[model samples]
Target: MTTQHLQNRVDPWGQLRTVASRGTRMGNRGILHNDANQVVRPWKHKRWVTCMLEFKQIKRPKPFSRGNYSELFFLDEATAFAAGHRPCGDCQKARHLDFKEKWLAANVDAQLRSAISMDDVDKVLHAERCVPGGGKTTFAATLGELPKGTMFEFAEAAFLVSAAGYLPWSFDGYGPAKRIDGATAVTVLTPASIVRAFEQGFVALVHASAGLDDPAAVASAQKNPS
Candidate 1:
């Protein structure tokens, strides 16, 4: 018998779901699950973060142990960022620092101080990525203004903006590329602040499923189904 999995897989919009595949990265938003092993809340704190699946070869056979932060999964770093999660300072120190540096550099201005803490970052991100009650915060942007690695909602579906074009997102993997007009306005899934980080040279790791070239090539692969 197959063991049942919980709803821990996170999408670009930060909603959780149960999927057969456990994505590339692990994350946490405090203890979201209850003693019954069911996810009871969206988040417990503002320090939402993503980490490497395997850190220092450490393993947790039980991902949602009692009193422990619930384990969350993401398809890739881009998904995590779009979900309003930054790199974990503990498990992903280097990336955390890098993200912090670039994030501040991109966001800070004459009104803000050069030195800021992660808590401040969390506060800003929380305000930008979530609504007062419950919902992912989104904004409108034209395709050309959005940087590569940004995710956007087009035609009621989530898609990633790649160097070549926009690739449709899925629980299984990304689909064929669909090039659109650069001036087309769309709802961006990634937070406005984090999108600025991307503009400041922060690069997100996309899944290899998007490695396929142009639309024709990806379509051909999808048709062949190797």
Candidate 2:
């Protein structure tokens, strides 16, 4: 329960604060990482969890949506999946065993290798990591909202959203929305972009299913597809 309780906690951002150094400076998890502090501190009631795949620490922008869902918690919790954490045994034992058996990652903000491969990252995260579980988090923009096929060149290959669709993305351990104006102009495809994410699989580092907020939510969705 300590870790659950730890979720609500906030951390102040300062030059010394880890998040601040990493450029998680703006609107961090609905909180700010302040500077000029003698010590680092955490926020209150940080009980939400990360249930997606994340290999590296990406930098996210402000004005995003984490989204309310049937089962997942927070996908934009900045530090949620960067290191690693397994599922709760009481609610997710079988998957938890599988997770532990594969890779035991607990997100640590300190400098170190987070994941060897994207699959290595997935082992600790649930497959259903989505934005702002239940309106708690979100990506403000949409694919149609962005210039279709616009390219954002970070360190990796150029990323383009399919046909002006909106999808969630995280860079340098932070998450944000990436939009493309047209399908033909880009190579990036997403569940939201192609609208057939089930078949495509992990276009981004993380994503969530329709039903993944909690046990009750998951159970309810299972009974009712709508």
Best by TM-score: 1
lDDT of 1 by residue, 52-154 (tens): 7766878676878888899888777788888999999998798898898888889997457466889999999998888865599999999889998899999
Instruction: Report the C-alpha lDDT of model 2 over 1-226, residue by residue, as the tens digit.
Output: 1211112211211011222111211112223222322122322123222332121344332222233121222222222222122243334355435433333223323344443443444432322222223211112233333333222322333343333233333322222344334332322221122122212231222222211122222222222111
Q: For model 2, where is the 10-residue window of minimal lDDT?
A: 12-21
TM-score of candidate 1 versus the correct structure, residues matched by position? 0.90
Worst 10 residues of 1 by lDDT: 217-226
Clashing pairs in 1: none
How close is every model to the real structure, measured as TM-score? 0.90, 0.24
Candidate 2: regions farther than 4 A off: 1-40, 43-73, 76-79, 104-226
Which residue ranges in model 1 land beyond 4 Å of their true spot?
Answer: 110-113, 212-226
